[model samples]
Target: MYDINTKRLIKTFTDMAKISSPSWGENAMRGYIVNAVKKLGVTARQFRSGESYNLLLTVRGDTKRKPVLFSAHMDTVTPCDNVKPVVSQTKITSDGTTILGSDDKAAIAMFLEGLRYNKEIRMPHGPIEILISCAEEVGLRGIKEFDTSVLKARHAFVFDSDGPVGKIVLQAPYHSTMSIAVTGRAAHAGMEPEKGINAINVLSEIITLLPASRIDHETTVNVGTISGGRATNIVAEKAVCVLEARSIDYRKLRKQEVLIRSIAKETSARFKARCAISRTLEYSGFTIHPDAVISQIAATAMARIGIRHQFEVSGGGSDTNILNAAGISAVNLSAGMQRVHTTKEYVMIRDLIKGTKLVLSIIDIMR
Candidate 1:
């Protein structure tokens, strides 16, 4: 029997680590969660989308009161297979070659195990919904595919950030991709160099003129990659530059985009070249007021567990961004993970217990 009042943290975490789940390949992991959650006598089911699927488990309570949702992604980044995790002293990490995939799995184990404890003790609380999303590490595709019609929650807690458990991310940047394609005529460098219109040269001018790195207080831009050139002996006929821009403020983002486009236009005019620019929104940003109901609830919950709560802004995007866009007020919660997405990633045992205590504290206070 699973112990609710007792700490089953190690058991849950061990089970989660043994499971293999990478990006689109999460069927096996999703199935495992479904079966594990079913043991709690709660309704747990999977919703299929192409090859991957999302799992939803619901724990009924007295009144709906707009169920509170707990969310975590099921997928991990690549090089996560055959992870040989070891716990030396008080931290857990992998053995050099692969990632431990604790990113969201740790959150998963903590949340589900928390629920099992609450059940065993007959904890009084409102309805709680669990959403284990798939393919979140690659893109927000799994979250994007989720059907809001099936959701009854008005507030969500996305356990996906890396840091202390008491920390909450209420703001994240809007991300966009900007591409510029330059077309020109190719000519032999030694013979007809003067006859060729150099697209690479035009792209260079645009890059130099554009305001990259940091823009003002909240916006940032970077040129991630550049390509398209045949040989050094030839004046390149075509070239392409790919860049990205991010901002917490929509206006600032728009201004940055305009600045980038203006640079491209000016470069084309000065060099007498043809160019095309394109913009695509990777994800929209979200900011919640300090006094927002969800934020207040979480703060109160954390405080009850003796951990000071801090509401802060984040530069990275997560499933919380997508859920917030879907009208579900969601906040990103930190799990005290250090050096994440690296070979040295580790989580302190004390921090893990504190995080679990925070989750349990939230449930106890919810009633």
Candidate 2:
């Protein structure tokens, strides 16, 4: 077992998890982190975006080596207000009404513990920057809108993936979000239903043609939300659907995107209605070799801590995508969080402590 202060990490996690820090409303959580850093005798700065604030803590004077950034988001999903963290002997969870907030808070706690340990040990290390961001759970808006120009870290480690302790995210996929609108002429359903075209039917045909589940090994499509038809007695005038497709291979992604666009236009023309389709490149995908600097650093850290180092692909998106897009080589590491974004969310205390030890080990290695 790795040497780490389990009590301190869990206490700090409990304190933060109990706070109400949903998506864009992270005022309380931000204050807690800022104050906690100050109490630890470290100064932190804030970067503002809309109603949320991102906290940045720098440790430069201690080490004269290259810089590395450790990032974790402070926000959680909905039903997180008034969280009650239940700490069992082996696990930590919520009271079943709200999320336990371990998705990112586990990272926050582990980072804090590692910082505290480093301070106590006075270990010689490289420049380290701690980034506690906001509004990540919603759509990765915090890191997306962030100004990385102020950061000098060449490598970043994101503590936001959900898995066991020793897993490293080797690659993430590129995502294309599509918003489509299907329009059809509206007429009274009882009187002239035959004269009107149904927008819902047009959209349904397009969806069938488009990929929904697993398209390939590295690609997947999902229809998150759709709305159409105001009343049963009337033909639908307009319908809208929000869908997204992600793929590790750019060629495959483009092909599927083209197919989706084709489906939209063809179905719209067949129904004699207008089809409006727009796609946004949400974030670029990245594939990091295991021998890369960041990956090597983490693998060495894991080996030093006597943990198995396994690199895997991530289907979900995180702040790692934003950092990589900003030209910083990075990988998302698991924080030992399980069943995130639900009332059933829980994390093993053993895994949490192991995760903390892993961060501490990475920091120690740079020293």
Candidate 3:
């Protein structure tokens, strides 16, 4: 076991949080990490990207075993810029005016702290790689664009989950983003209301027919955003809704999609409104077998670090979905991020220390 520098970890976190990095605005964070790692005698390479960049750092460990990749997203959700991270007695948080940037910053600090501790203590381990991805908050964009074909690691751990430090998310639901467009005739609301088919009315019918909330324990639907209506005096000519559905079961997920499409077609026919529906598979769901080596390794590591091993299934998808799709087995590890993507986001100093220890334990588990 190695001791993590509590002060150094906090400094890295507050420094990175103050960078004000959003999805596309990750260059500053990347540059900071590159320089920070270089100062630790570790070389990092940044890949060229359009708005965001991906960084990779490789360090040869004591053995010839396969490398284990540790991943953390560089970007936080909106309202991240101008973040004022405040370190208190037990945790670090924001001033409530902006997000704390702890969604992944906590994990970023843990990764760096783990590296420094491992190097100082001369921990016996295999090769190690750290992947700092950008634009993950937007839609896992960085990992999507990253060339996984160039990666040599066979196993990966994504430290971006919420909850305690030992939570291992082995499963997540498949996600589909949908756009519903309705076109109807415009007319005077008071005068020729009968002549116009109100698109808003049609949209309302569609919404009523679809599941507006959780369909089941593992399934859900949400009409996240809606826009329509030109003015209060006239009947709306067009209405649109952006929605998403997710489910862990493939059959249930497909059935939900079919039901939504059927409702759109039926409602459009009944109201004489033109309806256009488009759906994109955002990410496929993944479930790792509990008996797999990765899961066993994480369990052992957590136990070694004196943290309770908790296996969980996330209702939301993550970079682990992309990694599993790309043939790299991975799990999402909780980095003690609480209330992420919100103004209440915060990370505990205790969990940060524990998380860093867990990472080091996982590395030693391999040896």
Candidate 4:
């Protein structure tokens, strides 16, 4: 069993929390992490990207088993710049002004601390690869830019989800974006109202006809926002709504899209409006068997760390979805961050320490 440095981990965690790293603005954070890893005498490299660079670090191990990969994103959500973290006696959080960004910075610190501890103690572990991705807060573009061929291991663990340390997410739903355009006649609202057709009315009718909220056992639809209006006096000539549909089952997702299209067409025909509906598959879903080797390894690792565990399914998607699609059986690990993507985001210090312990245990499990 390897012992992690509590004080060093806390100091690193606090230092990382202070950095303002939002999506597409991860350059500073990446540079800092790269330098930190280099100072530790590890091989660190940066992957070229449009906005932010992906930091990749490798730690060689004995020839006992295949390499194991650990992944976490480097970017936070909006309002992340100029963060002012407020730490109480038990936990660390941000002021009311911005988010705490525990969504991934906590994971990054834990990974780095784990590497430091492993190197210091000379833990007998397999080859380890640490991938710090960027722009994950914005539609997983960072993972999308990753080169799958560079991966030497088929088993990976992604530290990104919120909750207790033992929560393991093995499945996530596939997502798609739906854009509906409603066209109608433009006329004065007060005068010639009869001659004018309201696109808003068409939009409302379509929304009312579609199956929203919970679509089925594993499907959902949400009309996020709508726009397109000029003046109160004139009828709206055009309106558009950005909607999203998600499902764990591909066939079911396509069925849901068909239903949305049907509603659009029916409402448009009824209101004498021209409707154009377009949908793009944002990302595919992934399901890993609980009995697979990857799950077994993670379960063993968590158990070794004295943490109870269970497999879970997530409705949201992440880079794990992309990695699984790329043939690596990736599972999302919980890191104890709460209220993510909000100003109230926080992570218990105890849980963060336990998360670091879990990472070290995982290394031993893979050994």
TM-score of each: 0.95, 0.95, 0.94, 0.95
Assess candidate 2 and give its TM-score to the true structure. 0.95
Off by over 4 Å in 1: 1-7
Evaluated at residue 315, the lDDT of candidate 4 is: 95
Span of 10 residues, lowest total lDDT, candidate 2: 59-68
Residues 1-367 of candidate 1 have per-residue lDDT tens digits of 2234323676676567667898889977887788788778679878875579988889888683457888999888867778777776677787867777778888887787788778778877788888989988876888888896798888888888887678899999999999999988899988989999999998888888888898867899999999988999999989999999999998899999998998898889888889999999989999999999989888988876678888989988899988998899999998767678876776666667777776777666564
Could you tell me how far off, in angstroms, the CA of residue 103 lies in candidate 4 after the best superposition?
1.0
- At residue 150, give the lDDT of candidate 3: 70
Each prediction's Cα RMSD? 2.1, 1.7, 1.8, 1.6
Per-residue lDDT of candidate 4, residues 1-367 (tens digit) = 4567877887787788788898888888888898788766678878866677888888877767788999999999978877888878789898878988889988988998998888788778888888889998788898888897887878899999998789899889999999999999999898799998899888988887887889887889999999987989989989999899999999999999998899899889989999999998888998888998888888999888788998999999988999899998899999889999988999898788888999898888785
For model 3, which pairs clash?
none
TM-score winner between candidates 3 and 4: 4
Error of 2 at 101 (Å): 0.8
Candidate 3 Cα deviation (angstroms), residue 66: 1.9
Clashing pairs in 2: none
Task: Please provide, for model 2 over 210-279, each residue's C-alpha lDDT reduced to its tens digit, 9 standing for 90 to 100.
Answer: 8778999999989899999999988999999999999998888899889888989998999998999999
Q: Which residue pairs overlap in candidate 4's backbone?
A: 189-233
